[model samples]
Target: MGMITWNCTEVEEFILLGLTRRPGMQIVLFVIFLISYVISLKGNVLIIFISRISPRLHTPMYFFLSNLSFLDIWYTSSIVPKMLINLLSFKKSISFHGCFTQLFIHLCLGGSECYLLLAMAYDRYVAICSPLHYTTIMHSSLCIKMASGCWIGGLINSLIHTLFALRLSFCGPNVINHFFCEVPSVLELSCTDASLNKTIIFFCAMLVVMGPFFLIIITYGYIINSILKINTSVGRKKAFSTCASHITVVTLFYGTIIFMYMRPGDIHVANQDKMATLFYSVVTPMLNPLIYTLRNKEVKGVLLEITRKRHVP
Candidate 1:
């Protein structure tokens, strides 16, 4: 059972006016998005495959990277493909339940990515701060538990947010201005006082977003300090190189996320929102495999050897 009414009793479906309002913009969006989707899937899937097949990558860092790639695949799978279809269709409509389902799955996957990054940061911290203990701290069993915990934790957190939305009294005007069933978008359609929902969202943001950000800041602050104490130039350079790629990825992922959600809802532009969705959805997934793997010589060597053998044979 559910409860959420605005002014009217029913709203069967919603029109998704994705991205741009211009009639001619659909074609451009389609071509660009199609390429992005293919690249995104290929990039993320290749990482998981490489991690599985390459014995050298059976370490704690790669294990988390594999899980991150898997999460990317699941996350992008939730939103981008359906969005591609909607670009061409004249009736860009989705049922209420369909919207909520999309909402749930998207949050489940996206939130998981947030936690995965945090885990990866911790991994980097261990590797750098306590080199002697890194192996012992991040064993296979612990790795599995950490990854599983991330998925479960993200789902529970997303569930709490989504249920709040489900309980709202959506009486009428079911048209969500944005491309997806974002919490703010759904809340806007409700007739009843959504102060509770707003409060919950704020609290969730503090826990999910601010919490991670603070922890990451502290981790990196220590990392920078540790790097400075190294006497040899080569040691400092080596230390900086090891963490540089991870830091870049973290910055890009969190920067866009902060920009998109941490704002007054009144200022939102649907097209900009769609583009913001693209950052974490399409771009970040493609980036993780390319950026992280490319930075690591071992993965690149393995990739080259595999490619060369495939071409030769």
Candidate 2:
């Protein structure tokens, strides 16, 4: 009992055993992640800016896209800067409070994103399935409510898990074998029996991640059926094109998350987990804005107009 108690001294900080130990690799990774982070911030901010100024993009789709941009900005910012710093610095330590804060914010943004994707899917469904009732159903008030619900649900879900995690006794061996603080990564260091913590993670994930994912699948199922019903081949192609960007983004985001979190902690191969975390946290945010804006004619047209206006001077 004495030895056990001695081993269970409350941890003050944690060392993040980041992606690589090789000095050369660290430098290369730092440069790559830095560029990716800058591009992600710039791209998402531009999306928000264009969404605000462009009257043509004042519809529900762009509105949700703007929310997604805002979320991606906040989400990536929560994880990447710290990761970049850790990659360059010799001391890869984060304080206890900082870890919790990161965990809370990361979960909040991720959970909200899941629901936001569902909302976007529903918007697509309305646009395609019941075109006549689209405006009536997705009015300003309802859109605001749906967006608010996504954020609020995410916050509530994060708060629940964070509060419970705080109750556990984190004893010794405080090196986290991942880039940033995540639920499963942190739980690995707990001196207490972390079965409960793992259970909460699984349950919350099912609700926050899997639940929205299944909804998106169902919504898209309806959407694809509707697209199939279109008589003209051109009409069907156009409809599929409208959805292609979104489908790509969804697949990218959900695929990484499900692969990372849905499995048991024991099976999470260390290097693989680190790379997967990088993909979702760093890579996905950068890709999202590029995917949406590059594929979207309305966004391109607005950007071109902005460029033209600047050149006019």
Each candidate: what lDDT? 0.80, 0.91
Off by over 4 Å in 1: 1-9, 264-271
lDDT string for model 1 (1-313, tens) is 2545424337777667677667689889889878877887898888889889999988888899889888888787777777888888887778888888888998788777778888888888898899899999988898899899889878987898788777766768867776667777777888777878877777777677668877988998998899899999999999988888888888888887777777665667767776787787777877787897779887888899899989994
Reference-based lDDT, residue 3, model 1? 48
Residue 87 deviation, candidate 1, in Å? Answer: 0.3
- The weakest ten consecutive residues by lDDT in model 1 span 1-10
TM-score of each: 0.93, 0.96
Q: Which portions of model 2 miss their true places by more than 4 Å? A: 1-9
Report the Cα lDDT for residue 191, model 1: 77
Angstrom error at residue 72, model 1: 0.6
TM-score of candidate 1 versus the correct structure, residues matched by position: 0.93
